[model samples]
Target: MIHIRKSGRDDASGLAAIWRDSVLATHDFLSRDDFIEIEKLVCEQYLPKAEIWIAVEDGRPVGFMGMTESHIDSLFIAPDQHGKGIGRQMIAHARALAGILTVDVNEQNVQAVRFYRHMGFVETGRSPTDDQGRPYPLVHMRLGEQRPTDD
Candidate 1:
């Protein structure tokens, strides 16, 4: 059985590995050099500063999420563990914590967009680049709120 828990300092390496594997599985649009650069940032910067949650099964972390306030900064499940409801469980947990939730997903990551839509998130806007000013576009979404209608 999988359970959600807060991460510890010791879990950083394991979680970074999961991040690497999950990105390789899902983020096919990333260039090789970009992947390596992002991996370093994740390991050396982002993961350390963010509030993270882990999905553990059998005492091992199989997935993780990073959140800031009501926004979901990142979420990744072990590639081998996909379609097993771990992502869903983590989103549910985040909703419980933050009330309303928001997330920005890469436009190229169709699978993640579909999952968020299935969880009732609606597109609020779009950006021409990701947070890091990369060329990957982002689809901004919000849950538990009515989508804005153009006047």
Candidate 2:
């Protein structure tokens, strides 16, 4: 059986590997250079403020996810484990911890957009251009509308 658990310091390398693999696997939209830059960005900006989780099967990590108070920052599952529902479990685990979850998915990433839609996350709106002049649409979503958890 697969289990979702909080990621510890030791899991950083595994998460990094999974992130790298995911970027490479999705090269149709994300280039190799983009992957390198984003990996560095994720290490610097996204890691510290967010909480990480791992999906384990018989003590081996197969997937990973990260979250901040304002967003479901990152979710990456090993390519081989994609259809096994690890991603869904990871999202549910994050939801349990933080009821209101959000994410900014690339508009061109059709698979991600469909996945988020299946998960019940609606698109709030687009984001402003950064210093680089790239305007990426931001999809904001909340898990529970009635009562958000304090934890």
Candidate 3:
């Protein structure tokens, strides 16, 4: 059985390990250096601001998902854990915390795009580039029904 729980600073190493492994397994996308950078940035800044959740199976952390008020900072599962509903569970948890949840998927990450679509997040818009002028295409997605309170 998989159990989900909040992660604290002690979980940083676990999160970093998961992040590196996942990125390396996707050799079609991230280079090792890029994954390292992401691991550092997420652990140092993003995860701290967000609610970080870890999926533990038999006492071992197998996946994690992080969310802030306006965005899903990260969602990653072990390579062996894909297609096992962990991602869905994480998304559901994030949605429960916010009336509307948002996330950005790189245009090049086709698997992630499909996964987000399956979770009912729509392509509301796109961003042109990364702050450093890298031409990375970002697809924005939002969840929840439209309400009169939407702004």
Candidate 2: residue pairs that collide: none
Per-residue lDDT of candidate 2, residues 48-114 (tens digit): 4468778999898898787777477778888788778888888788778888788877666567777
Candidate 3 lDDT over 8-82, as tens digits, reads 878878877887677666535655566667667776876666688999999888999877675887788998888
Q: Which residue pairs collide, candidate 1?
A: none
Of the two candidates 1 and 3, the one with more favorable lDDT, higher being better, is 1
lDDT winner: 1
Return the TM-score for candidate 1, rounded to 2 decimals: 0.94
Tell me the deviation in Å of residue 141 in model 3. 0.5
Model 1 clash tally? 0
The candidates, ranked best first by TM-score, are 1, 3, 2
Task: Write one digit per residue (lDDT tens) for candidate 1, span 1-151.
Answer: 9999999989999999999998988899998988999999999998888899999999999999999999999999999999999999999999999989999999999999999999899999999999889899999999985567699
For model 3 the TM-score comes to 0.83
Compare candidates 2 and 3 on lDDT and give the better one.
Answer: 3
* Model 1: residue 81 alpha-carbon error in angstroms: 0.5
Q: What do the candidate models score in CA lDDT, each in turn?
A: 0.94, 0.72, 0.79
- Per-residue lDDT of 121 in model 1: 95
lDDT of 2 at 83: 79
